[model samples]
Target: MAEGICCEFLKGLQKIKIAEELISLGKIACDIIIISLISQFKSIISMLFLGHLGDIELAGGSLSAGVANITGYSIVKGLAMGMEPICSQAYGAQELTVFRKIYKKTLRLVLVACFLISLLWLNIEPVFLLLGQNQAIISVAKVYITYSIPELIAQAYLNPLRIFMRTQNITKPLTISVTCAMIFHFPISYILAVYFNLGVRGVALASACNTVITILGSLTHLYLSRTAVRPWDRQAIDMRLEDWKPLLSLMVPSVFSVCLEWWWYEIMILLCGQLSDPQASVSAMGILMQTTALLYVFPFSLNQGLSTLVGQALGAEQPARAQRTAIMGIGVATVCGLLCFAFTIVVKNVWGKLYTGELEVLALTSAALPIVGICELGNSPQTASCGILTGSARPRIGACINFVSFYLVGLPVAVFMAFRLDMGFLGFWYGLAAAQASCACMMICIVVWTDWNHQAERARGLTQTTEEQASLLS
Candidate 1:
């Protein structure tokens, strides 16, 4: 009896150890998932609310989102991408002076960009009209555009602060910030749109309000960074043209290339709305898209975690370790992708049914499910590869690869297969299979050709090469 008890105790201890490991992993997966989910949740809210306004409004919202989301997300996330590598490397080397300087400049950049965005909002109606959208849509979209504009500034500041914490793996606060924002934004948006009958303009205002609230909270969280802050230099001034060149060089290509990807998505929505069943297509796809986007949190989070670890590791001159970390992240993402795959394949129709009872919409989404799942499988590896490259500060290559894979190759082929053949919504989604598949193939190629073994060495050389090009500024 004592022997049995002893054996049971040992088994319990083993289980505890296993549980700890899983918990550690869960934290990473959770952080990224939260980041992606919270960021995209506003869109989900807008979609759900707008979905109720009949198919025309639903179609308009999706088109607006596709155009608006691509514009907003690509620009904001593009700039935000700059924050991760810069902070990771700076923090890795314990360079607080540089970090502060970078922060200041980045903040200035963000503020300036936001002002420009505000002006754009003022003139967005004519711009939409010029783009050949319906007159009514052009009118409605202006309000949403105005609301989205103010949020950009908030996101600019918020991105740096959130990413700064992310480098330190302090994601709980960011998560809370997003949660609180949603809390404030959702009911408020609902009240404005439904109760007050403010319509789409209310959505714009609610989103802007949400951004301000979240940004303030995120800024407050940064106080902790000062406490955890290592002993470092002061005089938060740097004429370090060298420091920024690397960041900008890496960022530009990525920004330009993704423009195409964004265009394809935005344009697809535009085209989808012109379809025979615009309302059904938009409502059904909108729900499914949000579901897929939410599920995307895990893989996207894995990508962020891998980038953080790998970038820091590369900064610390441990390229082999970084490579292994990337592999592990991919492995984890692949597993999660499989789960999402099953969810979409086996239970997507179930999800569609739960979200709405419309037989027509359900039928469309059901037809699209198989293609969507397949897209995830291809997208997971490619998505994770984005982090792998960003860690190396070699974003241009990834960007170019994605551009070719998605636009030059993916978009044209997809459109032909879908529209030319009248494959309908299913055809449209099937095209992504080609795009994502090509992207996956290209990203894999880029990763393999890049020297994971000497990533740290490459980083050091990048610093040197950057210095050689110009004098450091003050």
Candidate 2:
């Protein structure tokens, strides 16, 4: 009877542990989702104000934004991600000095990159002219991008700071900062765009202003919060050549992984313009892409949350807990995917109405929405597994897997089915579904087969200082 009671108690304890983890994951994910939504809403507000100026303003602004995303923002975001594993692990291991060093190093690297990107932005007109763009549109794009350089500089600070705070599970400050910025974004944008009559240039400057506000707010909170306090080590601040090697090693592959995936979507949009009915096909594709992005928010949030939890667990030398977190994260991703699938199906007939009134676009969207739903079943798990890989400091592996799945397998299938076999636009989505399925399967296998104990050892090696390791050994 005593033994039976002990077993029951152990089972109950396990149940409680699982519940606690779920709650923690949910809280982190929710905060991240809120931040993402607010950011997206800010973009919408900018677009709306630009649209009010005229279609030319809207088209030019939109074109500039796309170019900025492809060239500047994506690369900066990926580079910032390189610090995730190090920061998460350092915080987990309670190596506050290491964490601070990584943050400073990443911020410097990103700022340098922003400088190069600004040069490119300044000379973008010749490139756009070479691509056969309209002279008027290119002229407007030049103005918009030129004024947007400050925003890139702001991102250099914001991106690294966000990753640093996130790894430490300090998200509330970020949320509050973004919220305050958003509240001011509209009025500031209006004053500049309309009150000052600066057109798109004013709008771009307003965006820069918004980011500055967010940065100031976040920094203010960090300064006041005792939990986030980390005094900079004078020696660590003076980084040597070797100090940058580890970060670059992780940063390069991460850039490739993120850029490869992002470029694929842009390529798809370009391909749609080549279709027989270019207007309708491109319109439908745009609607579908927007739908996909909206569905992605939750899975992406889960990805970030899981990355932190797994890195923290491994850093703390709890291999078993890290493994458990990986499993539970995948399970949660599956449920989220199912819900996304259901949402697409239920809204299929009516969803396109939100974006457009054309019957042809609506019909195409209705048919393709289910395919997108199917894709989510795989995308959710793939995204979650990426987080696990990131936490384990094995992003190179994920990059390789993404290249094979998206470019090698998915792209050819899309071209062949869409053109060779006459599948049209639907064929494009079918190809995406295939890629997501293959990517998910491969990533899930990798996560399940990971040796958590080995990863913990790696975390120790990564997070500990030379002195700390040597002392521990002695």
Each model's total of backbone clashes: 3, 0
User: Would you estimate the TM-scores of all the predictions?
Assistant: 0.83, 0.96
Measured on C-alpha atoms, candidate 2 has an lDDT of 0.90
Q: How close is candidate 2 to the true structure, as a TM-score?
A: 0.96
Q: Give stretches of model 1 more than 4 Å off.
A: 1-26, 46-66, 131-134, 187-202, 224-226, 230-243, 273-279, 355-358, 461-474
Task: Specify the poorest-scoring 10-residue window by lDDT in model 2.
Answer: 465-474
Among residues 3 or more apart in sequence or in different chains, the pairs in candidate 2 whose N, CA or C atoms overlap within 3 Å are none
* Predicted candidate 1 versus true structure: per-residue lDDT over 163-253, tens digit per residue: 6677766778778888898888778988888899877767766777887887777667765566554222355544566556655665566
Q: Which residue pairs in model 1 clash with each other?
A: 32-301, 239-473, 239-474
Number of the top TM-score candidate: 2
